[model samples]
Target chain A: MAAALTRRRFLGCGGVLLVGACTGGTGPAAPTSSAPPPPPDPLLALLEEREGLLAAYEATGTAHPDLIGRVQPLQSQTAEHVTALRLALALPTATSTSSAGSSSTPASKGGSTSGPAVPADPAAALAELRSAVQASGSAAESVCVSTTAERAPLVGSLAAASACHALMLS
Target chain B: MDPTDALQEALAAEHAVIWGYGVVGAAAADNILDRVRAAEQVHRARRSDTAARLHEAGAAPVEPEAAYELPFDVVDPPTALQLAVELESGCAAAWRYVLGQTDDAELRGVALAALTACAVQATRWRRTAGISPATVAFPGQ
Candidate 1:
């Protein structure tokens, strides 16, 4: 899996060749000795979105321990998504502790302090989680449509998986 | 593969799924027969839509086989539910392959919807069958 992820990143960087866009005269001047920064990857937003969803799962699980049986499996699946997206972006894997969900820690690179607070009622909490999953699935579907063919399968699968997760939550 | 080729593959899977669902509906208990019938109807619609899309693209849509070989004997509700999961999983894979074959946004949208439907239906069947962790991390991978 790690090897495949590295290969995808290598191919993506080599194939797209965004240098022309980066080097266009409209951009700020770069030092001649250094390479310009690569354009922001679209997948980065998706990766962060997955992380946020994972945090929501963790928050719900922690707040309502009785719902753990129902929440744990989905949370684990969401964690897998986080891992997959990270690998796809060629980002270093998060330490187990970080992903295990310390609420004080930011859920994503955007630096949100924590996931949305869980409702006191378990049923309501599940409903909230379902809404989040549905929204996430929509976001993933949009990304799947817009991303390169090489990346579409992964994103599309994530969108599908989120649909299933939403059903499970319901 | 060409986009049309991928669509043909998806159409073929939908054909097999429609055939497989007949066995599913037959073996499923009366309590769940409605669900089985609904699933079959969805596959039939998908098969028709896929075939039409292929025809529009000027490619021949593959026809369904007269009889499909079942992976196992689906003689009871348990086995029927299992077959349902298998059918959707196969369709999901086919549609996922289509996503990789086309850059057309419209085609990708259609493929994604099909894949998502398969994943959701698969989860429903798994849940009904008492499968733990009913949702997979990657639906079509």
Candidate 2:
């Protein structure tokens, strides 16, 4: 079982390598006789979803400074999700994109903001956040149900974590 | 591990969780007794469902021991709440393992739902106990 799991993980890493080679300018070109491109990895979509959730949490915190204490912990957890998803994909550790320029300020005091439109009311903002988390959880569950057993555990954990996040938001 | 073996393990965990919740409910405060009962009920239902699944798969589900050794003495409400958290965490871990041992979509759905339920319940227990960061990043992992 352990060897099987290792092989599955190695295959996942190979997928990431293929993606990287295809996208990176510095990487050598694919051979003329290369096999057909592999199917797109579902983990990439999950990674994007987690990064969006992190951004949404950060925006909510910025919009409602008073709610930062409540939001920061969940945001930190989301950041951890982003990291785990990256690790599952065997991707390089990039600088935290979600933390850039996330300093809390009073600039978005009113209802609407330049970035993500966080509701003016803290309760409403939290509700919105909860909805997003719920949606992401559903997505993760769908992927978990359909993906290979090797990938199911990671997405399954993501789904479970999102459920916890939704409960916290509630 | 075989999927049936994983299911058996999850059933064993559920049996233990149901038993642990008896201790949890006994020591829980009046204000939180409802939550304790609700959690216990869920575990009981899961236990029955898991046993049924194992039987359907032609595998004998693992039965619960006469009693499980408590990780720590459940002497008070705080300890009881901590036990509740621990119970759900165990359930989550078991179901997560099931996820990695099966490719059946229906089984995966069951495992994922159970994992999510346990993770949510664990967060609730943590919040009740005033634990920091009530939600874990990777619940079963």
Candidate 3:
């Protein structure tokens, strides 16, 4: 829908805000920034988006029980991801460079610790989930799935799950 | 499939879900209207977050057109659920494609989230339509 596309366009305007390392020192943009040049670190963006995903899930209601059950545990993992990123970001030592020539710093030290916990209102939860699912599915990057060996089945499993969701709704 | 590539495919599927829900949600009854709205929000949120992630990753996220072609006609909630089921299934496939290509532990977590969401949607649709949800996990797999 026109309204839907516009919503993203509105958000895109904030792309500039997602810049720079936590340190004041000058450097390339963060890896999460849309700019073609690799940013200082991608872990920050991952943390922000992970929160968004959890928020959406909390909004989803009972319409998607299967989805909620499956993802509830992973929500905790995403929180852990934020913690790991923050730790990585705080490391006094420099990180090794990826083969792609990109730097591999961890997430900013201030990443969130909140998991996607909420009251058990299946309907409300499903609504939240619908949003989270969209956000999660729409994200298309390799920051986390860096190696080729671990990538394929992850994508396949995601796809199959999506297909299964479609069949039930249809 | 590459991680970015997989995410793109899943994004496309999300695009379709967002598009199709208009008709399906509209037709759903009052009892389930809230559910319909929630699903719509899911699609919207997903679309936005996905695009942001895409941009963050330096990939231009595909813009959903002003309109999208639906897989089938939506006449009622049952029909809507039917369409939703189909859409969810397609989304599952797209996410699966992402699962296939992704390896990074973090990205893998995202792919798993996607997988779980789609499967839940599919199961919901099946129950809505009085269809059986197969006990075996990841039916296509």
Candidate 4:
């Protein structure tokens, strides 16, 4: 199905002049309108979970220098996944000031902020990473059920990739 | 979007990969040729299944190209492994789109298996090639 266009503009002056200019900026700059935040995109949760996985990989590498060779690649790939997921979800990587001036705050961070704990042993680290990947795969699968058809493949691939990672670490 | 379109595209990719893997297996090292052949068989099976599914759904499955343009020469074992990597990557990407577009639970399950298998095979090829970061974070993207 074609995606519905959610963004629109109403032009009052014969569809010629800008709506803001014609309305004399009297509508409180569109922020005081008190619109509720959009329900979180399920993909964002997957993305955040990926970030946590990256952090886990990084921490494992730091704690066990001997496993750096293995951990580094996983970390790099996890970071890449996070970046691709953010792009696919149409989310900005970094926070940007809102266009609605000084009074407007950027959207709140929508998902988990916790990172993986440092494991005690190399085997434990690998196990932790594998478990995390499995969880991520499950989460991505859930996102596939809720997202639009345009995004389902990307999300589904993420799940597949996560499973592959788990298999690799196994 | 029609889920069949995604399935047809995946079928096409599987057909291409099955063809490509024949070349890949031919040049692969003795140690890995069996694996390459196995991968080829996997894609062939998937291609057949996808076509059958599309037919059942009342959508005409796409036919494979007469021949595909190779991404690179499959000269030696490394190059052959690289080709396999590329082929499985294409397969994964195609199935990813299928998973996204399909709403049928059974079809999604099929697409998911195709995607996971392709991704695992790609990682194996990457490992055989001694490529860094053998497993991708996102297979299709």
Which candidate has the top score in DockQ? 1
Q: Model 1 compared with the native: what TM-score?
A: 0.84
Clashing pairs in 4: A1-B1, A152-B100, A153-B100
Write down the lDDT of every candidate, Cα atoms only. 0.85, 0.84, 0.56, 0.75
lDDT tens string, model 2, B58-119? 88889899999999999899999999999999989999999999988999999999999999
Say which candidate scores most in lDDT.
1
Winner on DockQ between 1 and 2 is 1
Model 1: how far residue A108 lies from native, Å = 7.0
> Candidate 4 on A48-162: residue-level lDDT in tens?
6776676677777878899888777777777677777778877665522121121111121343323346678889888988888899889887777667777777777778878
Determine the TM-score of chain B of model 3. Answer: 0.87
Q: What digit string (tens of lDDT, one per residue) describes model 3 on residues A9-37?
A: 77755554444454343765545455564
In model 2, the clashing pairs are: none
List runs of model 2 lying over 4 Å from the truth: A1-36, A98-114
CA lDDT, candidate 1, residue B136:
92
Give lDDT tens digits, candidate 1, residues B57-141: 8888898899999999999999999999999999999999999999999999999999999999999999999999899999988
How does the DockQ of candidate 2 come out? 0.75
lDDT of 1 by residue, A1-170 (tens): 47756877998565444543456655534343256557677777677676777778778888999999998998888888878888988877764634534422333335543546889999999999998888888889999998899999999999999899999988
Ranking of all predicted structures according to lDDT, beginning with the best and ending with the worst: 1, 2, 4, 3
Against the hidden reference, what TM-scores do the models get?
A: 0.84, 0.83, 0.47, 0.75
Model 2 per-residue lDDT at A114: 40
Query: How should the candidates be ordered by DockQ, best one leading?
Result: 1, 2, 4, 3
Worst 10 residues of 3 chain B by lDDT: B132-141
Per residue, candidate 3 scores C-alpha lDDT tens digits across B11-110 of: 8878888888787878877688788778778778877877888889999888676787776778877788888777777776676566556455776666
